[model samples]
Target: MRYAVSNQPEGATFQVWRGVLAGASASLVGIGLARFAYTPLLPAIIGAHWFPASTAAYLGAANLGGYLVGALSAGALVRHARPATVLRAMMLLATIAFIACAFPVSFAWFFVWRLASGISGGALMVLAAPTILAHVAPSRRGFAGGAIFTGIGLGIAASGTIVPLLLREGLRQTWLGLAAVSLLLTVIAWNGWPAQDAPSSPVNEQPKAKSPPAPALRALFAEYGLNAVGLVPHMIFLVDYVARGLGKGVDAGAQYWVLYGLGAIAGPLLSGHLADRAGFGRALRVALVLQLVAVVLPVIASGAALLMVSSVVVGAFTPGIVPLVLGRVNELLAHHPAAQKRAWRTATTSFAVMQAASAYGLSFLFSHSGGDYRLLFAIGAAALGVAFVVDVVAVARSK
Candidate 1:
């Protein structure tokens, strides 16, 4: 079960890729299936009379609340358990959550399981890439990080395509099907993690009360949080907007979701390659600009072609921004893995907090404004604009 760090060329390459697969599996199950699968199912759940609209919406938000909890506690959990152990546990927890969700015994029951799924996702998000990347060579870490996050895209793609097909059978069957897939992935990744913890460096081994995070790191936290706000509109409402708001059928909305999934699949690899070639800072800035435009596209124009573009572009950046921000953290804290983990954790927590707040806030706004999808998109675009400006100013000041 142990994948010892190997000295031989082929052995090292295999080991790195194995760890990558494990990390990807964790992301795929934890974030992709656990968090996103719920989105496509939201309407179905409401339609089937499983829950009323308001309760169903609150249940969706429960995951976000639990995610914030997970992000805040991931480090402490790792301190008590091996990263590999923690990763496996979280994956199992996600699988269990999926199974538990099939019953829909009561509002409280669904809420608890949904929240647990989010916790699994948040913990995996915080821990997976950094742990796996710790064993990868620095020169190749960008690509490796991107590969790991591809699981998220894969999950999204599956949610769009597979969930709808599964819905044909029944909601309970769909949940069970997802659990089967998650369990299979969990088994595949069971032994791919490195056997030992990442080697500690002098920088991290210093006294606990070291200097505060650098200014750039601080700015990154804010920018990342803002990016979360920017993404909320599409993440929460894309399918709904297309299907309900735009007067398109659910099938058409699913098609748009599929396109979004396609963009997501390409986004991380492209962004990672860009980070390798151009640097994480520049890659992040470019991503922000692209995301800003994508978010605003719907507001400016809602043609079929333009809506498709918005879906794909915004979808690409949804999960795409993750690797960029993670890479930027690594770049900023090079040779300081512990610090990088801490900074990444803080960034993730910030993202989760903002995402949860914005999801609810935007939902409230949409409800109050008579389900104004354009207004939601406009607000998201504004958030991205602010994030881009903040990042630019931070980079200038750092220079």
Candidate 2:
């Protein structure tokens, strides 16, 4: 009866929409304004002032590194801190960093700011997942989680679309404007946020622990890390692979990007909902199959129709898997409050580690392979195949 329905009224249904919006806005500062905007705007910033490409890449990586640390800290800290409070602090840090970029600081100073932004970005993502899902009933958590992940894609798309238009205003102005928007979003999150789900404790009280061994949850954390590797290829390099590897022009690449983003936005919610009804494992298998088709289609057909189809298929399933994965992680740690904290900490740390690995792998592959990314696509397809197997095995064993 734990997952049984309550005799609630129409107004008492799952808060999936609200959770998704909160997730989107929270994610915008982290994924869009802070983390993602830098990619497109970097060229402009470099052009405006001279900086070596290596230094810029390093600075960018610094942000990712910061995310790793922040995620670990937030996962444990969320047990003590209210989710809204943590999100607000992270948002504030990200906003300030964006505005600070306008000041034209020294290379060392810029790296520090980037690091701060990265930390906030990581924290925001980890906190948002659970915070949003907690608002929904347990039966609906999968759908809610998937819906919430759409926020990340929305943020990415917004950054891609907005930064290019704002390039005319100069990087400094754009940075300031992004900062202002972030601050406004933070305020909205503060007012609308629900009460914290963690146990209450006084300032001098010890952090409470729920009954359970930590090792079980730690195993789930390792699985999360593996899942991260499974997800990276389609996300980070899909656009470049389509453009350079497939011989499409920039315009075609942009179109494919739009398609993929749209898929990312839509896929999670649909998959999550389906996962809830059909079982998470079955839903995941379905998504992975579609994603595989998306990955491999370009190997044969490089035309616009196939390219767009590929983007959409890949996009649809890409972000959707996150919610399902987190839901499973949550199931493992449900009995122990302290365990939840530890598990989240592990999830965040693993997330950052995976992202770093994925980025490095893509860069190394491209560098050594003379920018031919077909092999990269093949590798991605293979990884997903393995992930599909894992999902099947996990589900079958659980049953």
Candidate 3:
């Protein structure tokens, strides 16, 4: 009879922490610095005469568009290349983009770099969690996932907090500083990845194919799309909305973003814990409710304390929902791992595409609405409301 024990090497536990940190660093550099940094930096960019404020929507959309392209590319790249190699290369590219943006170039030129940044961000978002999880024993997978997901919040918080302080030096210096930080994070994470890996694994595409029903699948796709729609206001304009929309200065706005980031740090761990006890579907519903509240709160209340709560909830659940949906997908496809892989790719792509596409639409709406972010927030809240209903239906059907 064989007795069960962890098959990990003696130092595996130690390396797991390193891998976790590495994964978080990936998030920090990609989502934290490369992608979401635009939020706090948007006002600074405008103030520095780098670009017209009118182009904010296009700029945000460009990043999301590049993110979509990156997501599609990852699906192909995984088939032919090593994930570790790909992950590191993307980090390096993101670092370069960050540094390059320090130069005040044409709007078109800066747009290209932002696009590249988004692509790298998208790739890392898809890749990092799996890479980190590979280092942990199966029993601790949730912990690994939580550890990895926290990187988004960490990055968000860093941007919210650090970018404001650095702006005192000037926006150009801020970009240079972010680029250096990105380089450091990339190096640390690169070294933390397993020195060896199988030629292919879950992070890479393997042919496992199953199709859920068309209507149910469509509903899931819709929820994925709306998730981004509900999120764009906070992601792209939270700082500006607070500063310009609420009559707060940029500093106050950045402070709110920091609080938001702090809340984000709690989201994934609590979400995972909740999933462990209540089931992924139930936990997801809880997240959706909180997210809905987060979106609607700002529209209904303007007080300092209330808006702070709104910021926290938005920040927390913004990155929180992704893992929960991925968890649900895994559950939905428990019987067919191959199909699950395909489903995940589909869900992820749909989500990215919606996010990319929605940027243009929603931004146009905001600009057209005479810059009344309340209208924007209202629309965003409505999107979340639809997501809530769609999610409830999808969860029931999945059951």
Candidate 4:
């Protein structure tokens, strides 16, 4: 593969593009297979009587808890480990977790695997972006970033299709089958990434003269944390709520989940494009409004048509929020790379903790209420509304 050299900015070629593809593949391996595969599997595991709804919720929370741990440790891990090593190891564990779920193991054992999977996924996320930056050309970074993130969408789309088909064989077969596919993907993404984490570019290495305002920290941290709470409904219950709760078959739920994936695939590209014209703050506010409306619609409306629309809108916001929020963060930290990296790590930590806590809290609520999916959606909507308010206030304060 052709490597970009110090004097040859113009030499960025197909080799650079291949490295970007590797980063994207890592994304698919990490988020797509690890995080999203569970959503589709939630209903199947329940149907097989592997766990009750409430217990299933705890398992999901355990995965996010692992993510929180991973996110918190990401910086230190990068310092001590190679990006490729971390990526490969995490992908292997995630693949193992997928297959482990296929066994009729004890709940404690299953939980351990899920948590391991979450840790792997979270670290992969923290590692993948920087790996790309180290390899891709400057002019191509934006496209590269989009490609990597879009892996989540692609993985979701694949799970939506592959899981449903495999379930026809049996839930255990589905798990094993998915594990096989994940193993293949891990190998491919491993090949695509650079052998080292040595960044050719100094994207975040510049020293800043001054730190950002405290208000900047408060605004971003709050926004990031609350954003995860707003997403708990769909993340934990969207498929099950439709299939088991609403009396729709598993296939219908999978179909809607696919729609959600399709929305996710499109959301980042479209939102990023709009953010350019309208500005990140303005674009994000619009998305929050859309997301809030979408969250509330399933409770208000009764038709399949409206449900599909809500799924797409909700799905769009889930992955879509990353670019929008990161854009706003960049705006705040433009002059201070050191401050920017520091604040982003803080924000990421906040995000992981909030998401993990909400997963546990909501799962317990669902159990106590005997699986009241509507209540969960309402709570999610309320959280999104609060996030919208925080964002609006932040924009106002910036002015």
Candidate 5:
């Protein structure tokens, strides 16, 4: 804890440790952990009741929809208030949303609850990036950001591992236990991430002040939005591609996910270090191209060896690219405070919207194509290729 706190910046002394915990906990409970629990837990939940599989899936789509709403809400609200306060409040909302899962209800009600949870959780994720980066030293931003986002991976893995074990007890008991954990996470965020006043604008006194207009905002949104469309098929479908589509068992799929998490942990740390040395934009472009290659693996190979290799490559590609994207966005607007804010907001909100679109598209594809994941995988590969081109153009234009 002391080591983690040492690199935390000045003005962060009283609150840095708490902020990390708050950010990490908010990620764990708000979006990654709580929101994703539905997927792994769905089998157990459905086994206990006799609901249609499609209806259960609707709950997921509803959550993504709520996430889009929450993300937009956070962007609008954060401009007027401190980010930490927004993060804490959203964490509380997400906790309650997760708890909503504990009760047995009709599919329609489940959809509503999930939508609320997604909106809250999405805001929580958006709030976290700025709140953590704003307080940290510029030199340490990438590493700290990586450490912070890793919480999402941890939370997601925890939910995956826990949901199955809890089912051994009973559906109600399983959900109750998860709800308890989410509540604990909420308490941590509310208490640990207490708000601090934002520093006064450093450039307000200068005569050369510039602010981004609607045109700039739209441009940033388009760049980030297209990038996100590429990630959706991969991030949302990786597990299913390995498990159901490839004829592998659930355990093997879980192992592949675990490998992904391990790659996630390693990739970010290494990418951050290298980005500092090689330049963020260049490094990020290389990484995106590599990911494009990784996404195409499923289409060419079907064995365990290819699957394992793909897991490692995709794992390294996905989360590793996040910090760099945010860092570049931060760089692009370094001269304009307002542009910086808008860039971050656009990046986040568009991310959620793209995720929802990806989910809906994948679900529709899976339904109609007679479960041919190959078409979806091909789509994912193409999106990644498009992302590479978009990123190159965006980076060049910014320069």
Candidate 6:
């Protein structure tokens, strides 16, 4: 079923673009600054003695836990308030979390704020694209959705570049700097959201009968969850792997992160375009294959050039998979706006659960196994391999 777009008066295109930007800003704050920025800062926080290594690691995990909570609750929150209201509030909450983190008054205090930021990120991830895409023409959603998620990549890139510069000033300054950026984005996006009453679906599109998700959707959920696990090694350990594992030092690690950030920035746009040309299903399979190769590359070849390739490819798929999964949800549930939202929430929650589990599980393995980065990457590769096989078999069986 083809999704429908609402009719609009003259100049609606500009409003749609504005809404897309607002959605992007929400993602940047929630995922980019709120989540990704912490990675580059983790070593600095540990090095500064703000908290012991164990405490600091747990604090990092706090966000993932909070993300799960937010994903679980976003639908309820939206039911009570307009999507715009919830989105704006979440963005503000994330900004506040950033400011509160600058003090480090206590581990509990820092953990609460980190967790709050994670909550905001999770809600934003769940709601932003779906909300904005509702106002977009169906024909443009592939690109518009990609444009919205570009915020995540922007956030990743900022963590690599801007966060490093801020760290030079002091930890407090870095947190404050992030807060400032978040605030600016919040304000810019404030008026970008469409009216609360904007039509959820095209007028002529009839609501479909509510039913259990099809097999293809269940397969997508598994694929997305496993993809999260596959991403853990790079998301959590890429910097450390390049800096310490490879004995390249902090500066070298940051450089590799920058490369990762660059790849992330390009990944969604490229993938979205591919989805538009081929199909979300086909695009997703291709992504899984590329990701599998990238994750295993480090384990097989440790050369600088190969390492760079690995970083870029994995980084691209990090946030890149979001659009493909989202598009697939819409494709499967076309003409069912309400169902689309529910499916997306389920998918987001599954992703958060897998990501948090893999992070702690892999971290434990890394420590107990004497910092074996290759072992972690191998595990990640295995997860991707399973995801690819599952997707292929599911598609084949459906036929």
Candidate lDDT scores, in order, read 0.88, 0.70, 0.76, 0.75, 0.69, 0.88
**lDDT for each residue of candidate 5 in 241-308, tens digit (9 for 90 to 100):** 77788778778778887777666656666676666777666777777677777778888888888777
- Candidate 6: tens digits of C-alpha lDDT, residues 38-57: 98898899999999988998
Q: If scored against the real structure, what TM-score would every candidate get?
A: 0.93, 0.84, 0.85, 0.83, 0.87, 0.93
lDDT of 1 by residue, 84-152 (tens): 899999999999999999998999999999999999999999999988887776667777888899899
Residue 44, candidate 2: Cα error in Å is 1.3
Write the number of the candidate with greater lDDT, choosing between 1 and 5.
Answer: 1
Query: CA shift at 38, candidate 4, in angstroms?
Result: 2.3
Stretches of model 3 off by over 4 angstroms after superposition: 1-14, 55-57, 105-108, 134-139, 195-218
Model 2 C-alpha lDDT per residue in residues 337-373, reported as the tens digit of each score:
3444456667768767976887798779879988766
lDDT-wise, the better of 2 and 5 is: 2
Residue-pair clashes per prediction, in order, are 0, 2, 1, 0, 2, 0
TM-score of candidate 3 on Cα atoms, chains taken together: 0.85
Q: Pick the candidate with the highest lDDT.
A: 6
lDDT of 6 at 175: 96
Candidates 2 and 6 compared: the better one by lDDT is: 6
Checking candidate 1 for backbone clashes, the offending pairs are: none
Question: Which segments of candidate 5 are over 4 A away from where they belong?
Answer: 1-13, 79-81, 200-205, 209-220
Itemize residue pairs with steric clashes in candidate 6.
Answer: none
lDDT, model 2, position 333? 53
Which candidate, 1 or 6, would have the higher lDDT against the true structure?
A: 6
Model 5 accuracy (lDDT, Cα): 0.69
RMSD, candidate 4, Å: 3.8
Q: List the residue pairs that clash in candidate 5.
A: 66-119, 67-118
